[model samples]
Target: MAATKKARQPAELEMIGGKSKRQRIWEVIRAQRDGLTCYALSRRSGVDDCTTKTYMQALERGGFIEQSNETVRIGDEKQYRLIKDNGLEAPRLTKDGQPVTQGRSQEQMWRTMRILGSDFNYQELAGLASTSEVTVSPAAARDYLKHLAHAGYVTVVAKGKGRGAGGVPNRYRFNLGRYTGPRPPMVQRTKSIYDPNVGKVVWQEEVSDDDL
Candidate 1:
């Protein structure tokens, strides 16, 4: 019989209280406002290099994070922002049939509702928001619409009207207006792919993925 090497003892990935260490680490990493080094994360989480490195590797594989050199960044980072689009309808009115404004935090959402008159869709709302200097990610816009619909601030009319329809693309009409506060400045990122072998960031106007 061939001698099979005994499998290495599995390490504990989750802690006792409730959430696993990986989940906790993910939360902490997600809370970081800017790029974080793996060393910093290890120290902050009080996890040893072996555990931290293993968790990070697992996270990257799960698509929960992105890595560049020594820094790690969260994926779907845009979910933290608010979005606006046309598929939104105005908020519901009062007994008197007047616009009902809700809490301040819902302001941006309310604005979205108002802008999305009859049959107003995400594309139009996104265009309006982009032009208005309050840029929003397409992902954010979809989340906001669904939130409004769930809160009864708006109602979904068309379940799926476009090809991109899935969780969103459900048409909505507002039931009331709300405020979320002054729009935060849009984050403008310009990714410059680098070819360290060539010692420079690639700037070709057009290049196929194979070219890289």
Candidate 2:
């Protein structure tokens, strides 16, 4: 009988714990105090010229950047200078320069955890971490706690009573000693824990043959 070929897992690209193309472009512009043209930004950041222009347009509208008065030939791409510096974290904006709402909860929860020095239940965490703008549901809090607990970033003070006659949610305490940075340790879809502050995947679950 012929032997069967074994299945292989597809590798993840620069999707996990890596900066976005816009972020890379922003960093390049920030480093170039003199300024850089759209073409130059695209070349240095390894992003396509067209995509760079689109992001630059949004950045210009958001007032994060402005045109630099550098000499250029007729019809040459515009030179840009960083104006409102937002620091290391990339500004998440829509193509139209509108702010995006995707990662707000992650930031809110991480900041709240840093301030709460005592153990708390997931319900309490959700309530406290949430704001009028960004509402963190209990489910979201529970999931975050689960992943962090597995990664040793959070200590489970007590297990929860399931949604039974007298259900009580799990109580957990953040392990400050394990705190990597201000950025939250993200639970990636790849079954991994990515620490943006450290810019690395601190933990990942082992893949099984059955999953291949």
Task: Using TM-score, give the best candidate's number.
Answer: 2
Score candidate 2 by TM-score against the native: 0.80
Residue 113 miss distance in model 1 (angstroms)? 1.7
Candidate 1 lDDT, 49-71, residue by residue in tens:
67666666544444445554343
Q: Write the per-residue lDDT of candidate 2 for residues 1-212, one digit (tens) a residue.
A: 99999653222244334566777887887898456688888889988898789998888888888889767789886677888888987677888888888878878888898889899988898999999888998888888888988889889998888685489878899899888887777777789887766677777999899999
Best by lDDT: 2
Candidate 2 lDDT: 0.80
The alpha-carbon RMSD values of the candidates against the true structure, listed in the order shown, are 21.4, 6.4
TM-score of each: 0.30, 0.80
The lDDT of model 1 is 0.45
RMSD of 1: 21.4
